[model samples]
Target: MIWKEILIRYGELSTKGRNKKDFINRLRANIRHLFSDIAPLEIVSERDRMHIKIENDEQYEVLMKKLPTVFGIQSFSPVAVCSKELDDMKKLSLIIMEQFKEQEITFKVEVRRSDKTFPLESHEIQREIGGHVLRNNPNISVQVKKPDVELRIEVRQDAIYMMAQIIQGAGGMPVGSNGKSLLMLSGGIDSPVAGYLLMKRGVRLEAIHFFSPPYTSDNSLEKVKVLANELTKFGANIRLHVIPFTEIQVLIKDRVPSNTIMTTTRRMMMRIADKLREEIGALGIVTGESLGQVASQTLESLTAINDVSNTPILRPLIAFDKLEIIDIAEQIGTYETSIQPFEDCCTIFTPANPKTKPKVEKVTYYESFTEFDELIERAVRNREVYKFPEVNQVKDKFEGLL
Candidate 1:
């Protein structure tokens, strides 16, 4: 029988032991919801691994493209059919090997006979396949530890699966499994990476972008929108809030001390982010602030910023260096876009020697001169909100493709 299935590998979830079944069930439900439009795919649980099977091949391919974005799966393989017994498994392995027999390479048979009742054990089957392949094609070498190609045969209760490759998955717990946060997204290298990491941990994200258009150009705003679009590939459609930060920034520069301008602005930003988070049902706020990554990220400065946030502020990148953050940014396809020479509102103002540590009382003194609270309220109330849908925009929701 030729049927398509998705094999899922969990990471830290397996450590849950007795609680593993609960996680698996939740993961299955999440997967089903994400692929709701494609087909009715049932998730089959087997010990620590989970397999997804659909009625048709087209649905399998569609799910393959979508499931990699899912958080729980470490890697997946698309396999062909076989039987549980030794001879049928070897026949299928030989046929698959013949397709790649001539290449100058090494190969090994990896067997996971879940059913011990099968006549031969996993190691015995691996050796038998190695012997058969060597007998048919003398030039191929037998390398056990690691090989250029691994022909895997998994023996299950109902069927045997064979495949030559494994596809990498998004790798993390399922989204919503960790709860939700509002990410402070800037049109720069760091914040998107921060959001990506949060999502990897199964944290659902909504974004708040501070824009100083005219000072920060239309291209800068568009750059942020593009960045959000790129991130949607990982899952969960994002609702991005664009706020007019230019006015507030100018007020801070003029009213506050030059040394404290950056700190004061960050404090105001935290206050505004907290309000936005409360309105949107987010449990906390996320930032890309890494320790010693920048002047404003200093402990004293962060403390001043934190004072305004009654809600928890999560800095996922707090301990990571610039190089480490950049390395991951490159891996997740955001580095190229992030490194673009477009300035966002955060960098446009004149604060060459901003304060590394700021006092809350001093910032309060500066705010006394202007009605800053009113300005923040207006900015949040009149913010331009855009929602990027989770499903790909092949067509409009009702109209369909033309």
Candidate 2:
């Protein structure tokens, strides 16, 4: 009689088997957190399915728009709850058939009875529902194999659920489901894109940005925040840690040969980033480095930089070309913000003829001269932290709209 339920589907969680309960529990908690603002809705979990219910209809549309942006869900549908009796099911079927009259719709009834005592089998219920709907509305055809609208009916112990529409889900494992990584987020075209891809694959990311104030303007720092905000649309509300790198950068420029400056600076960044990663419990470090993209991204430079970090270094865009990465950047809505003219740490003190390939020994020798340990410790100590709001906060702001 009423559309009061939301059905959730999991693409990869199906494989979790015995440990599925933990994953489902985590997902349910996250969903509860996500919709914390919409008070009338309740989230429920079962052995095979997840259901979200609403005491009022007002919150449904808002949930429809927002839940698709969440990371853990594969797909969801807004469903009606009604009596399992044939007459009630037929009435609802006619309403659904009438609603989609404009399109050349091929719909079918998909039924499942958790309480097997229901007299009819799933297929028999499907056929019976199909006949009832056909009798009421003659225009819509029935396609058992491939239907534009699948009217799903579930006969539970206490209630019967039926729904006609399925909304596409974000379709990935949950962020933090995979573990944590420290992304080296520069306000650049590639790094945010790289960060987005890693986050898409269930990696919870915290960002590390090197800032050289007076060298890199405050506007540039703001740009990174803006970029992180945009990434929040994809469920990565990253904690950005800004490191002071002006002195270390200046020392690198002065002590290292001009051609080797980029390479030397990158290696130092790897060391500093690794230290911070350990301090913060990050399992690995992520970078925007793409193969052969620039001088410092050359194989030799990448190898030298990799040598410094004891933790795993994840370069999501390592194999992607500029065009390929840009396509993804545009798809994720970061391309526009990334193109803004804001300098990042790498642009500070850029050498005209930076080395395409520098030896590790040379980079090591340069580091040995200065108090490298002291500089890294100082930079980490002077770090700035930023956090984003939880789902409840989002609701607090948008409750009136709901």
- lDDT of candidates 1 onward, in order: 0.80, 0.80
1-402, model 2: which lDDT tens digit per residue?
266878898877777778788778777766766666687457788765688886665677767878887777888888877787878877877776677876677888888788998888998888888888777666778888888888888888876778888888877777777889898988998989888878777888888889997889877887787677677766546788999999999988888788888887888888888988989899988999999999989899898888787689899898899999999889777787777776778987787888787888887886677778889999999899987533344322223322
lDDT of 1 by residue, 1-402 (tens): 244576777766777778777767767877876777775667788777887775786787787778787787788776667766668867877776776766877888888878788788888888887888878876578787788888888887888888776778888877777888999999788899999989888788999999886888776776677678767767667889999988999888888888888888888888889888989999989999998778899898888889877898888899998999999889877787777777887886757788887777887787788888888998899899988753455332213211
Candidate 1, residue 41: how far the Cα is off, in Å: 3.1
- Inter-residue clash pairs, candidate 2: none
Q: Candidates' TM-scores?
A: 0.87, 0.90
Runs in model 2 lying further than 4 Å from the true structure: 135-139, 390-402
Candidate 2 TM-score, C-alpha based: 0.90
lDDT of 1: 0.80
lDDT of 1 at 127: 84
Task: Report the poorest 10 consecutive residues by lDDT, candidate 1.
Answer: 393-402
